[model samples]
Target: MFSGLFLLAGLALLLINYVVVNETVPDGTGIVSEVVSGEAGAPPPEMYDQVVPAPRDSGQFTTKVARTAVETFRTSTMRQLLIASGIALVGAAAIAALLGWLTARRALRPVHTITATARRLGAESLDRRINLDGPQDELKELADTFDGMLDRLAAAFEGQRRFVANASHELRTPLAVQRTLIEVAMADPTASPELLRLGQHLLHTNERSERLIEGLLVLARSDQGLVSQGPVRLDEVVASVLRSTGGMAAEQGVTVVSRLEPRLVFGDQVLLERLVTNLVHNALHHNEPGGSVVVEVGDQPALTVTNTGAVVPADVVPGLFEPFRRLDRSRRAGRDGAGLGLSIVRSVTRAHRGVVSAEPNLGGGLRITVHLPGLHRALSPASAPAETLGV
Candidate 1:
């Protein structure tokens, strides 16, 4: 396209030069003198002949001489014009290309910003906005529309979170009442064998209901976002959880092993403890009679728990963190779990701004890892008091 423009410019210059050469430079100088010879009061023909040379060889020689001079002038002028035009064309093309590149980059700046903003926006970060500033062009309008959509999404998620929290809190009262009634019925001295069995089953059902409610409450709370941002010693949290669950692990005949390092993180101490407890409990609950559970604490503020259990398919590992997701239907039928342990683990981890992943062991087990943001300073029992370290 540039080449075509350059060619057209050169041709136009040549055509203009042709017209100027013909109009400005006389075609035959001898003819002009003869035409004025017969004019009134004009000099006599002989007088004019003396001043201007007589027409020679039917004036063809003079015409040829004039034509040669015109051709020479046109050729030289057109050569200079061609050189100038070529330079101008090259410079114009370069400038246009540069300007075009810059213009395109500038035009797409808002799109890049939009992409970045979208990537950053998530369940926990819906409050962010594009807030673009510029003229009321198409890009600016697009940014405004995006910001509006985000506002709506933030409102919707906020509403859903609130509803879950409120509903969970409301369910706790009735669940407590049911547990109290079931316990009272079980304590009756005159109850028959069949009645006692029924009462025991009711009691068990009530207990499971209570656990489910508690799990739901914890989940809602975690999803509500972190309320406390305090330094939490992960090693201490793990130690405390181990002590609390020692009896349960003993009943299951599962050995609990640990490699605790003094790793400090910033989050709610209770939630962090819950996260560790859920992982440890899950490991213990799902293991074989002689299986062992290994817990590791490292400087990455990371916690890993691995346990020998029934063979778990690799395909099912990803769904373990989802709510009400269980690996085996038999486990659910056996009343082994409420299927909320790993789900709560994930929720609390996210609330603490951490990440959790799970992978199946080679033989028959599961390994779950949680990585949290670590504090810069190294924490040790001697460096700080127990309470200050959230132990």
Candidate 2:
């Protein structure tokens, strides 16, 4: 566009010069002459006419000089004008480009906002919206549409969470009643051997059902989000979990070894404890006899639990965190597990704004790591008393 404008300006200047030159230099049959007398006092010459042939038409010479002057003036003026116009055109183009870039960036500001909001949106954060404030333009309409979708999604997730929580609560009572009835039947002295065996089986089944319900409730609660938070000592939490599971570990003949360091984080203590307990229990339950379980606590990756067990394929480690996911022939034959340990671990970790990962060990068994944000300063191990449990 700039080039076209420059060409037009140059052409206009050339046309004007052509018209001016044509007007200033005329075309006509005219002659210029000067009269000369032989002497002032002398009479007119008698030989021939007194005019001396009119000095050979000096008008043509005068016209030639005039045309030369006009052409020179026109050429100089056109040269300067062309240089100035070229510079001006270049400068105007640069300025326009700069202004256009800035305007485009400003116009797309809402698009950037929408992208960030979309990246942050998730199952837990469906309530977030891109509440853009501006005139009712196309971009504004897009933002409004996105926010409306999030509203619908938030409502749906809320309904699902409520249903799960309610169902778990409703099932608790009947399960408890069944467990009580089975225990009473087993305690009756007149009960036959077959009846007592059936009662024991019923009791076991009821207990398993109760555990499942409890796990579901915990998972749903964690998904809803944190109720309260405070500074929690991760090392202390690990110690507590180890204490709770020491007997089980001993029964399974899995040696528990730990190198715990003082690490402080902000979260619900109960959920944190549950996270540790689940990981530790999973490590102990899936281990070979006389194998070892190692627990490490530090700042970066707040906790790590590695245990010796049968070889686990790399591909199967990811699915283990999904609800009710179990590895083929990985668990002990007679052991009882609800298969929600890793699922609860993941949920609780996410609730605390942390990450959890599992990997297959090169030799055998699995390694699980949990990474959580840490406080700036926390109590040292010496200042905080350490607790130990018999294993």
Candidate 3:
């Protein structure tokens, strides 16, 4: 700004100087000629140029004085104008620059606040939100967006915390039970048949542990989105799970019934089969003797497992599918299974872009509904329905 002012001032001064030189040099030369002619006494030619002349040098002196005064006033006025214009220009430029800087800072104040707030946020502080206090502008919108992101982060963090806690508790229960069993068996002296039974219990505990570990690995992989998805037959998976669980259901005095349609869906075949198996096993394990377990598979690739036993308590239904969540402590106490069965089922269903919900059956027990995405409309419909086991 200062440089620009100096350049303009210099140009104006040069122009003023040019005008002054052009006016003054001609008048000075004329005055010198007059003085020289008067001193040489060249018969001040009365008739030589003009008709009339200034009388007795009085008018000439007066005229010279007036001209000198006028010229002096002009020179002084020009000097004053240049000085005043230069001062005004410099002052204006300084004021404008200061005002511009202040305005820019004021405009960007919200941006600075946003940067500082974001810098203070981290994984542990994902719940922190920004305070947008200024006018409603783009900055305010940006703050709103940032706040929304923080909300999502907080929810995700909470979910992860819950999952870890539940997983740890579930994994610890079976080991604790096995330890107690071993301690009891060691304390018994005539532990012949008792010790043999303890060995069998330990073996069952080991199997439960193995199953828990395998389920955990599958869930972990599903969470990481490691499984491949394609068109698969839901009826086939259901039938396989039924065949696998047939013996267990029979031993429990539970009758397994099925009503299935040949439905196709896009999903991982292994995970889908596991999901069906877990649901059937959960239903049969919770049912009473002579109770019937009903399994239904539809064209939408939805499965409903209904068992006749004790009705599920209303309060526990909300979290029934969460890990380490069990409504019947008696049922879970002696069992070596980690209570992640339903949790794994829920996880697998979700991984396949599906939903699982449990509700109390009208008569006595619980009914679980698993909904999965079916194949595209372009595929031809299946011709036959398939039935499977109860467990």
Provide the TM-score for each candidate, comma-separated.
0.70, 0.73, 0.51
Per-residue lDDT of candidate 1, residues 1-391 (tens digit): 4445655675677568656755664433443344444333443353354323637545554445444444555567667866776677677667766776688788899999999999887676788999999999999999999999999988988888888768776887787888788778778897788988887888787778878878887887788677667888888888889878888888888888788878889988988888888898899888998788888888663899989988999999999899988888666533556888999999998887789999999978999999899888945545222221111
Question: How good is model 3 by TM-score?
Answer: 0.51
Arranged by TM-score with the best first, the candidates are 2, 1, 3
The best candidate in terms of TM-score: 2
For each candidate, the alpha-carbon lDDT, in order, equals 0.77, 0.78, 0.72
Sliding window of 10 residues with minimal summed lDDT for model 3: 43-52
Tell me how far the alpha carbon of residue 202 in candidate 2 is from the true structure, in angstroms, after superposition. Answer: 1.5
Over 201-226, each residue of candidate 2 has an lDDT whose tens digit, in order, gives 78777877787888888888788777
Which stretches in model 2 have alpha-carbon errors above 4 Å? 1-86, 115-129, 329-336, 381-391
Candidate 1 vs. true structure, TM-score: 0.70
- Candidate 1 local distance difference test against the native: 0.77
Question: Candidate 1, which ten residues in sequence have the lowest lDDT sum?
Answer: 382-391
RMSD of each: 8.2, 9.9, 16.6
Q: Which pairs of residues clash in candidate 3, taking residues 3 or more apart in a chain or in different chains? A: 242-389
Error of model 1, residue 358, in angstroms:
2.1
